[model samples]
Target: MHIEQLKQKIVAALEDLKAQDLTILDVKAATSVTDYMIIASGTSSRQVMALARNVQSTAKELDVELLGMEGLDAGEWVLVDLGDILVHLMQPQIRELYDLEKLWGEFANPINHQA
Candidate 1:
């Protein structure tokens, strides 16, 4: 699938599960690992795990390769690695503590997903 389509599918998967504070960071210039980093928060550990699962399912449905996943056991944070994109699902407190937006702030452009 195209990158944009893959992104949309991933975002929709998160939104379907009511993921909060969805932020898409264009990190093409900052990192070589992935072109985009999607960050979102879940209200609780269960929600975080659910969101990650949904994203994984969506990627599978779209035939996107799932490179890796992490932090699912603890559910404090979950990282879904697609070849060109990385999805981060975390509880609100963990999200606030890590401050990924700020970490990538300098080089990442926050894409406005608003209509």
Candidate 2:
């Protein structure tokens, strides 16, 4: 799928699970790994895991290659690699510590998700 389409699918998946403070950073210039970085918060470990799984399943349905996934076992944070789009699912505290939005916030293109 195209990057934009993949982003939309991922965003939809996150929204479906009520991900909080969802943000999409345009990191094409900042990194060679991916074009966009999607960051979101889950209320708890189970929610975090569920959110990650949802995105993975969505990607599979769309035939989007999932390069890698991490933090599922810990559930404090989960990263989904969707070739051109990278997703980060985390709890409030873990999100605060990493502060990915702030780190790459300036580069982010606005997303329509509620914060």
Candidate 3:
């Protein structure tokens, strides 16, 4: 699928599970690994894991290549690698602590999805 369509699918998956504070960061200039980084907060570890699973399922349905996944065991945070896109699912505290937006602020074109 096209990157933008894949992005929209990922966003929809997260939204379906009520992911909070969804933010899409354009990190093409900031990183060589991926073009976009999608960050979202889940109410708890369980929710975080669920969000990750939903993303995975959606990607699979779209036949998008899955590069890798991390932090699923801990469930404090989970990262889904989709070649050109990275999805970060975390608890609110973890999200706050990491502060990815600020870290990538220089090159990031942040798009906030409010719902």
Indicate which candidate wins on TM-score.
1
Using all chains and alpha carbons, the TM-scores for the candidates as numbered come to 0.97, 0.92, 0.96
Model 1 poorest 10 in a row by lDDT: 106-115
Off by over 4 Å in 1: none
Ranking by TM-score: 1, 3, 2
Error of 3 at 95 (Å): 0.8
Clashing pairs for model 1 are none
How far in Å is the alpha carbon of 103 misplaced in model 3?
0.5
Instruction: Decide which is better by TM-score, 1 or 3.
Output: 1
User: Which 10 residues in a row give candidate 3 its minimum summed lDDT?
Assistant: 106-115
Compose the digit string of candidate 2's lDDT tens values, residues 35-70: 888999999999999999999999999988889999
lDDT for model 1: 0.93
Q: Return the TM-score for candidate 3, rounded to 2 decimals.
A: 0.96
Encode model 3's per-residue lDDT on 40-72: one tens digit a residue.
999999999999999999999999989899999
lDDT of 1 by residue, 1-115 (tens): 7999999989999999999999999999888989999999999999999999999999888888899999999999999999799999999999999999999999999999751
Model 2 accuracy (lDDT, Cα) = 0.89
